[model samples]
Target: METNTEPQLPYMPGLAGVPAAESKVCDIDGQKGILFYRGYPIEELAEKSTFEETSYMLLYGQLPTKEQLDGFTHELVHHRRLKYKLIDLMKTLPETGHPMDALAAAVGALGMFYPHINVMDAAQRHGACVRLIAKLPTIVAAFHRMRRGDRDVLPNDKLNHAANFLYMLNEQEPDPFHAKILDTCLVLHAEHSMNASTFSARVTGSSLADSYAVVASAVGTLSGPLHGGANEDVLDMLQEIGTVENVIPWLDKAQAAKRKIPGFGHREYKVKDPRAKILQRLAEQLFARYGSTPLYDIAVKLESVMEERVGSKGIYPNVDFYSGLVYQKLGIPMDLFTPVFAIARVSGWLAHWMEQLENNRIFRPSQVYVGAPPRSYTSIDRR
Candidate 1:
């Protein structure tokens, strides 16, 4: 008999409240419904900063000076175009495939082009960061247009990051109001403290994998319904409710049936998610700009009803709750909701990816075995 020598440690289901790595990238105070990136409040960043600048802060760990911002923005703008081969690759994917699937594959392939990516080289790391944050939106928008049998639009250098993405997706410049709202959405979503996808990114990056592989893994994690896909589900839920009047009855039925409602609860946030509050405001502003949709009305009613019923339970509307309403009003297709989330989140993933490399350690968490104990093997003919 072999003697057991491994240390016994308590097993936590899903690694809840486990600290995996130290990071200075982002922080969340779920109790207070506050989020900060590099010590700056998310609300301030969303209101006063551009996605480009916010992305810069997340990656570099500080606000950029005007000159620094210009250089960084220049790099992002210049790197926005994907190689033609990548576009051709997207053409081969089935139109029915999920956007996230296509995005993951394309990003993985994108890494293949940079086969010599040296994580140890600071210059190379900076290039990789710039290229990824620059190109993700182009990848998402290009595939979207291609799947619809429309020609892909080239990056418009004249536009800012958020506006340029909206331009590529729609083949026309978006209204300033729409672009500003979307920029705020991106800032809100750019980073969250150690989320599921960010954890996946860190895990993969800890293996010293290339940036693309790290991000691709994170994209795959985000595709799950409980994570980035919740915004899409929120839209589906809103459509199913059909009208504002149906909100309370639907909640009553869903609650009584014990069916989980999408977009209402967050694991990190005990109070109403701060991002959800901002997004709700953006939804209202968007409604005012483009005329209201039935979905927003229903969402409003649903929030009120949910508050009356479940607010005391620390289950409240999270970021996903109102984001879909805002995106829908912007004319983004429901399925692309998660892909857009990926575009914004790539910054956070890359930031964490770089941080993981700084103090790289392969994750090797111990798991308690709960299966049958070792049994002696018998010869085939003998029981």
Candidate 2:
């Protein structure tokens, strides 16, 4: 028998369960369905902290002092406005283009306008974080309006981050209740452990790319249907179900046909996603305030039926489940769902970028090539 001589390397498809890098930015207890950002439980932060404060914590690894938070928020508020040239550039994008593509394009172009090319400078990194977190909502809202031939609604200094975005998107001030709900949504989405987009940011940052490029790469990754568009899909799923009575039949048909029920399962969670619980409550609150809708009723029935069918298998509602209903109630357009996710996750991406820079090593993972080993090229049309 010929002796076999080949390296035996364990392969994990999609790099699953691989420890890509050490990160202090965020962690998940998948077994328990819990998430933490910089040592704070997500529940505590979502209940007690604002997006700005959560962003500060994720960036600096600690909650800010009162004075520190005030200063940070002031910087964010002041930097919210985009340069007119950037706005003019946004006007030139095809109005019907996906918002995520527009966002990625604008952000990549942003690299040309800002002086954040120096990735090693601490102050420059901080400025880049502030500018990105502040301006993303403005950029997203601007494109939303411009595409509709509506004039840009300037950011309101008096409003906090979430409310301001709502105001800019809709050209009217949002209710305080609605603003708080949106803020909690942002806090919940701001970070997750080693997610695809954060990993994209880290890998791009490993090349010492500037902040804009790093974020743009992550945005592009998130635009893919597999990663960031689940919420929108969930909304569509709800709309298709149409009524509480239709849910059981629809889910039965979907499961029998082996179609994935959007928002019903997560790779990371054996239990219901904690963020989904918060979002569900927010949805109920929204319904209570605005009165109920057919979609929410369908969502409720679907969750109950799904729990009965597969809950024992640890297949349950993830964050995307109820979040679509919440977003729809908040009046965000369906196409803007992922862009809003990008808005929240930018802080997390930057946090990962900074953490990647702290121990900068270019990511060059090896692969197991399994093609024909040594085949010589023959002359064309050789018999």
Error of 1 at 45 (Å): 0.5
**Which predicted model would earn the best TM-score?**
1
Per-model CA lDDT versus the true structure: 0.90, 0.92
Q: Let me know the TM-score candidate 2 reaches against the reference structure.
A: 0.97
Candidate 1: list runs displaced more than 4 Å: 3-7
Task: Please give the range of 10 consecutive residues that has the lowest summed lDDT in model 2.
Answer: 1-10
Candidate with maximal lDDT? 2
Q: Encode model 1's per-residue lDDT on 308-365: one tens digit a residue.
A: 8899999999999899889988889989899999999999999998888887888888
C-alpha lDDT of residue 80 in model 2:
97
Clashing pairs in 2: none
Candidate 2 lDDT tens digits, 183-292: 99999999997889989999999998999999999999999999998999998899888888888889889989999999988889999999999999999999998998
List the candidate 2 regions with Cα displacement exceeding 4 Å: 1-8, 381-383
Clash counts for the predictions, in order: 0, 0
